[model samples]
Target chain A: MATTPDLTKHRKMHRGSRAGIARRGHTVAFGQFGLQALERCWMTTRQIEAARQTITRTMKRRGKLWIRIFPQKSYTKKPLEVRMGKGKAGIEDWVAVIRPANMLFEVDGVPEVVAKAGMRLAAAKLPIRTRFVVRGRA
Target chain B: MKSVALEAFPRAAAKRNAVKKLRAGGRVPGVLYGREGSPRAVEVDQKALETLVHHATSETVLVDLSLQGASHLALLQEVQHHPISGSFLHVDLHAVRADEKVTVSVPVEAVGEPVGVKTGGGVLEHVMFKLKVRALPKDLPEIIHVDVTGLEVDKSIHIGEIQPAAGVEILGNPGFAVFSVAIPKAEEAKPTEAVAVEGAAPVEGGEAGAAGAKAEAGKAEGAADAKKADGKKAPEAKAKGK
Candidate 1:
């Protein structure tokens, strides 16, 4: 199913500025290993779900996974061949506005090698560059 | 407890700019406070501090800090690091007397593979990575080792069950789980079965079919009302335009 909030205060939202490094959710808190975003980007629900599936399959469902980012901002899209200037388009897909150093996924109860390999495959599914981080060390 | 000897220099400038300059010069600004005359501002070589941290087994590091010919036994209370770069920004050292009891959190290590994990296809999980304990300077342990060889599936080891070292007392909720061997989570159902289940439920209703039908009827009524209102407003808008 498509990921979207059931309730929202505002159905439409403006595209705001994306600046500054992530001050929180940057550390590996839940798991022993994590994938940290090195570049800022809007991660859609599909992308996050795809990465999660990749990580879970890589680990063979032996470990636990934590998804740190949520698609909070909803973006709008105009239909095909539609003219401009009809105010803003309807709400399309929701996206998580990720910043530098934001931790995207975390895995635990698995060996370091397996977690690293899983994160590498998951990073391939994402749009931004990522860094493999270990708990306490990073 | 292992003690590392490090030399520090008395810092003259504690201002933000001064601290920034000091960091740029490869020194980490720190404060030594506790049972002392006053909190002393000091700086240590960045590389040295990093090495000390890298070599330590746990977060609780006992430091033999020497500043301006005076030696003070201090605990590495806190270390602030850059979130992105993970570089040392500042350090806080707490001077402690050898006779006083100090409370600290020590990393917990599980020794040996659990029986459940080895034979029962269970996953061993470290629920609590660190345990807070109160101990004298000499009694502080670098790390606490817990044996989990006999742990069975769905079984947990709690803090109350642990026996600490002599002169050290575990401080926290006694019932807190430290380690457990859990049965792996069940896999998802087959796609066809999941789809069949989804198809059985009403598409528009939140849960009950009657409530869902009622909501759909309400939506249709609201849409008809909106269309009627729009039709009435169109003529008024045209007249105003003319």
Candidate 2:
């Protein structure tokens, strides 16, 4: 999992899947907006508090927005273990991991919502992105 | 609907002064809360209470309201608001049947982006407007949808991902996105600023690079300090437990 952090740096990136381009769909740039990160689900009590401080101090004030981000951790238990073998090459197996990261945020004003959110992301260096914008309907 | 025998009282009955004020203004204050028994009322607004009810839990819930007339049986459904001003809207309600199941939409939460996080350095996003569901009054859920399986960055998720319990039926579109993940590009990642050295032997003009780094750091620090000078501080308060 730790290999080739820079591999994608060379490959041309686009929006949607390969099939989309094949059907005359050009991939738009993904996450053209902000900071992003990959972290374990579990956070210590201290880590959580620290994160809250970072978001509120920087994002809320300058951004003029209220954000709600909730990070979560998950784990899996496996039965396999490594045992000493003298004669042959060691063997290994593949496995998967999973977790959730639900969060939400809101801004008071219009247009400013996205701009402030963007500014907050820059200041906080948080690992999040803006996906879509919707208007509240009457 | 599974019927529940609920006991409710007025939320504002103790505020006699407020009631007096409302009575004088001709806006009756009332509450509508009940599962089995009739809804109680101290005073109900022909307009305001109706608007508040528009946003409340439905009739199966035990609402404690007051009215000028006797208490009655009812369920809350809708809350009306000013479309542009976004003020508190009037509430709508229905008289509940003990044996009937009421359907309402609850909220769903999704965390993290799958596609964006994996490839584009983007993260997951959520815009969970709401999800409608049907359940008996006795079986109401404050929130639902715990499992978030196939989500990825750049990929949108819908209501179909929710795993409803045996007795409940979800009433929204299967393609609804309670949450999603994406990288909409809010910032750019410039090369990390270099560390500065003080009076150290420069290697092949390393001093120039160091000077540039110091300048960037100064700029960043200046930005941070300016925030403090503005008297705009974040809440130094700690996070409370759920």
lDDT of 2: 0.41
How many clashes would you count in candidate 1?
0
**What does candidate 1's lDDT look like per residue over A1-138, in tens digits?**
336777889989999878999998998887799999999999999899789877876786477788898898999999787688879998879999999999999888789999999999999999999999998884
lDDT of each: 0.86, 0.41
In candidate 2 chain B, where is summed lDDT lowest over 10 consecutive residues? B186-195
Residue B166 displacement (Å), model 2: 2.2
- The residue ranges of model 1 lying beyond 4 angstroms of the native Cα positions read A80-86, B186-242
User: Can you tell me the CAPRI class of model 1?
Assistant: acceptable
lDDT of model 2 at position A82: 30
Best by DockQ: 1
lDDT per residue for candidate 2 within B16-108, as digits (tens), equals 786657655645444454465565453444455444334433322334323333443355554443322333333444555545777776655
B1-242, model 1: which lDDT tens digit per residue? 86799889999878999889999999999999997689989999999999999999875799999999999889999998887899999999999998899999899989999998888878888899889999998889999999999999999999999999999999999998999998666333333443344454222121234334657998999899899979988998899899
**In CAPRI terms, where does candidate 2 land?**
incorrect
